[model samples]
Target: MATEVTTLVEETSAVKPNGGVTLPIYMDNHATTPVDPRVLEEMLPYFTGKFGNAASRNHSFGWAGEEAVETARERIAKLIGATTKEIVFTSGATESDNLAIKGVAEMYREKGNHIITAVTEHKAVLDTCKRLEKYGYRVTYLPVQKDGLVDLDDLKRAIDDKTILVTIMAANNEIGVLQPIAEIGKLCHEKGVIFHTDATQAVGKVPIDVAKQNLDLVSISAHKMYGPKGVGALYVRRKSPRVQLSPIIDGGGHERGMRSGTLNVAAGIPSACRVAR
Candidate 1:
């Protein structure tokens, strides 16, 4: 049976006053975008034609779905200049931020319990750091300069022998200011501290090379690009030892055991494709 799929297409409607028409203008791209007709056409088959559970490994249908998911992972990794193995799919940036901070903090608590971050971070990152503090981990919330940038000297002053990690966002979500990530990374490297950045906004808008920046970990969201919602990725540099973190949720081993769940193969494919572009 063939399934019918309807792609929502939005057309500009003119306003009429006294039988006179006024031009319609689209000025809300920041809120949302019109769905691309081609994407809808490409996704129709997955919804009806070849619907299968990606986590079901007992049948060929499942294998096909699983393969698509892996291919998507590769695409996402390529876009970020990472290996597919380093990408961990999550619900979104919020989850990605939680995993990166909580995961590393739990894993490295024995090494040190101190984590440094900026005051201007998103609530996702800010709240996660606060939660860690409740668990006896010391957190340093460095204030940013008037220009919405963290002072490199403050970052240096915050570091101590007990400091295990430093997390900063690549750019400010509200103010649109880019951080001095490369400089921060260098300082962390010299001090043997792990550096992580929430690159949700910076990933597509600017260039990011993990190696050049000396980044140990980075967080990115899919929908920030042209991809679907509810999916994002974390980049953990393999050259560094795998980030150790306690799982917030216990389940079957997945996402290299850092995150666990049945993978969303459909969202993964398009998310990766969008990032690659």
Candidate 2:
């Protein structure tokens, strides 16, 4: 059977009794977006009939939930040109940013103590890098061009033997300016410095192939692309140069031990994977 789903979003505001427009027309998609009804409907069953602990492997319900999660993982991996084992779910892009930056810093301290990022990056990224400064880690906040793009020449100059990681956002949330991610990725790989991109604003909005872009780590947010809130993912490359990170949250060792906790199966799995592709 073929099933088609549609989303009903109110684009225009209705007039009030006094003829004034509605307070918000929801044009601020850069901040957050409304949940698509189709996605909502798709996820409803998991909260009720399909409700089961994905970690519980002893019953049919658990098996079903776990199967859904694996399918979702496969879908997400396909969207980014990655293997299913590379995707790690997180609460949101903020958590993913923290994990990618802090995790790499902690794990690769022996390799180097320096990290590179741009000034136009999201607060989640900038703040994390700022916090690392207090921990004796040297961070180079590269200056972008007047058009809000990072300079490749400047990036080449910034890298050194002590440089461990380079994190740059794929798109500017405020201006919507796209960066030269492929070039940056190629440079980072050649220099042996791990590259991580905060792709919250760019994942679904633009084309991203982790393998083609030579990206080591990439962050994604479901809400940013009309899937769901409070759910996101982090892509960790596992081949050629295997990227390893210390767990920021420790508990049940979920998400392949990179992020340890009970998976937010309902929203995190299906909703996040439904996006980008």
Candidate 3:
């Protein structure tokens, strides 16, 4: 898969003034997949003819791009049973993971400072937890069973009054083992703690109903499901406890100010469209 992605990147990068790069076989769907030519066609007009900033609403161009972005948001929300207002666009799973974890942590610090998670989560989740530890937040890294599953009892035991959040992955990226997210979410809810999952590896391949699972937050990546790269989203359940996140970077207030900067309507819209499928 890595080799195929490398080949595609090499070919795409080699396009000259007069000719396009030719791919040999196109078999690397794991590391990355080829962008659907149809999606590219749909996107071409935005880059040339109707280019406009979604954040800018003073002109027709801005309205057109903003409408497209909202339509894409609705499509993505439909896939996971979330409202469009709950989704926040991001750079990819890594950024989504960081936002979900750190956002909730900072938001709920006054309520508690401890967080719980398993050992087998993607580095994004684990590393974010570790960083929190350095800042006076306590993290409980739960152990997984031999089957690569987190024991529900262990998760229950890890929870304490100080544990404000629980983050886990929806599926194992290395082994494709689906976690019992519904069960885990139920457990968190029972204890009045927030639940978050990194669903980058499981989004398109597995069915995820955020409400059924009682997920407070979930992360997704676009490129994982034949969509454009550098775009993803995080689902933050509105009913969940309010979370405060100090922005890792600051710019124009966007994404409700939880994530700031100009919106990438082009990539965000197509990415959401792919996930809706």
Q: Candidates sorted by TM-score, descending order?
A: 2, 3, 1
Query: What is the TM-score of each predicted model, taking all chains together?
Result: 0.86, 0.91, 0.87
Could you give candidate 2's per-residue lDDT for residues 75-114 as a string of tens digits? 8888889998999989999999999999999999999999
> Model 3 over residues 1-277: C-alpha lDDT tens digits?
9999999987876645544544355655656665666666666787876688888879999998888778778878888888998888888889999998888887777889999998999999999999999999999999988999999989988899998899989988887788899999898988899999998888878888898988888998878776788888888887665445656657887888878877776774454356346
Error of 1 at 170 (Å): 0.6
Best by lDDT: 2
Off by more than 4 A, model 2: 1-24, 268-276
- Give the per-residue lDDT of model 1 (tens digit) for 15-72: 5464464556555543333444454455566666557677788998788777767877
Ten residues in sequence with the least summed lDDT for candidate 3: 15-24
Error of 2 at 132 (Å): 0.8
How far does residue 53 in candidate 1 sit from its true spot (Å)?
Answer: 2.7
Specify the poorest-scoring 10-residue window by lDDT in model 1. 1-10
**Model 2, residue 141: C-alpha shift (Å):** 0.2
Q: What is the C-alpha lDDT of each candidate?
A: 0.78, 0.88, 0.82
- The C-alpha local distance difference test score for the whole of candidate 3 amounts to 0.82
Q: Flag regions of model 1 displaced more than 4 Å.
A: 1-41, 268-276
